[model samples]
Target: METSQTHENSIKLTSTEDGIHLDGSILWLDSKHTGDISFLSNPQSATSKLDSRVIATEETIRILESFRKKPKALICQYNRPFAIGPLNMELLPSGVGLGGASLWVETNNKKILYAPQLQPQNSETCHHMQVRKADILILSAKTPYNADANISRKREKERLIETIKKMVSANERPQIFCEPYATGPEITKILSEEGINVAVHPNLFRILKVYEAYGSHVGSYIQHSIHRGDYDTLLKPIPQNKQLRRVFPKNPVISIEDNQGPRLDDGLFRKIDERFYIPSSCDGRELKTIVPKIKPREIYIFGPYAKDYVRQLRSLAPVVKALFPRHLPSLF
Candidate 1:
């Protein structure tokens, strides 16, 4: 076993660089070019109640506008390695979203895997699980309380199905709230197969259409048009091999919720009140299962967790809590 002296020093946060650690020192990972730059959603839920309650401030709008002005294309061609500064970056598909990726970085004879939310429960390829020989592995965790990551996706799916089936049997029209950007399509696919019609939010519908237009697998079972239009225009019947079905008469032909305030169920009809929300966030247990395989020299924990939980994780490998604000720019 290695001691603290052998382990890499703590990652430092700096203003100039986005948080990345290099040569055992914190440095910025540049996003201006393709080298050492990749995309992963922040650990926080993009669509949460608090977010729903508040409108974007001017600063928020400006920040978002800045991103739109200079958007970097993150290549998601699986298993293909691209150069990222000092690292040879490979984008691996994480099943959590339409095209979300788990970045595997290789540089200077070291393998560093950065997966703030690497989920492998539903994937047959199990790319996240395939990660081996990582010198430093970065993971996202559900804090305060440990994540029940031990629960398999199959089990989660089974549980969800059973719950929905029971609700349907009881004549309850359940509305499954899903993250617009990420897991909506996945959940929709599962529900549709069970002959349950899903009323998708417009945001999610648009994302699915983009995937479908590009012929992505996530959009295969998700029947929707890529044409940009309002709710009524999108709902209007269009010719397709897979005919769309209506969830309710008043709600129109193809199932879609209108863009309105984020009341959890924005456009969903009142009858569809029973909510079956899907929590697609990363679980802490993911690391417990992964650490033994990669056997990394160091591990960085991102996201929230209780102090005791962090202490317990010490036995796993050299552990460090990645405090985003404090440890701003870390490169490895």
Candidate 2:
């Protein structure tokens, strides 16, 4: 389901009685959108080395050819609307890069934020410092922040609170999900009193243990323990890992695992360079400023490259860039 294929392109995902056909760098799929990780379990089969010369023409042709053989219905998600085969693409805020086009939505219903996989420290400014209104912010609040020791100690909770103050109107109310931290718990307790829901998923213990801990918590909001590879960079709570080098701090008393690894870093997002992105969909103009400033070297990772959206980014100017991850570096 994942590939390093990037180009000035349009995607068509068709679902037929047989299976789904993805007409992009990927071709067709013969199953529900269960996800791409399971099929590509082997490192050899899943990973591909891709560069520009082949990106636009050759790679596009190759994947297009692959889909020709599948023969299924087609569906496309562009900007706000989506198209399924012949159906018109509907208009709704869309999410990019975080698996499919669903991430750009936030409903008013009693909702749960399932953020996982990304290192929290890296996005301290983008995720925490910025105010976003969510009924519940299900942070990957794993403790004993050994993986990236520098971030484990960062004042992320305070930043998130400050950001929230900037976002929600004075009358709005929301809650926070957190882990059992000296400060996070206290802050949540205070917020909960003011009508902002502050709750924690005790399952965070699995992330704090000395060993690669495992546990099953049949809870309302979560399922399996988030994988090291799949957690969202903006929402994932920090974990203990090799990023810390030496650990076993006196404060937590958690042990270490020999096979532990660091979260994905700069080297990971480089594969498929996109031209346009939809960060949050609030301000279209601001989104434009975010592009090129962070990682100018990388190609536009879906930066309103299409003739249609490109005009929107320029028109929105500053807000359009707000639709994507503020902290992650640009890719080429």
Q: Which number leads on lDDT? A: 1
lDDT, candidate 1, residue 186? Answer: 64
RMSD of each: 10.7, 21.4
Instruction: Write down the lDDT that model 1 would get.
Output: 0.44
> lDDT of each prediction vs. the true structure?
0.44, 0.23
Q: Model 2: residues >4 Å from true position, as ranges?
A: 1-21, 24-121, 124-200, 207-286, 292-332
lDDT of 2: 0.23
Alpha-carbon error at 216 in model 1, in Å? 4.9
Quote the lDDT for 78 in model 2.
24
TM values, all candidates: 0.60, 0.21
Q: Write the per-residue lDDT of candidate 2 for residues 75-155, one digit (tens) a residue.
A: 222234332333222211112111111111122222212121122122111111122232222111121222222432224
TM-score of 2: 0.21
What is the lDDT for 320 in model 2? 22
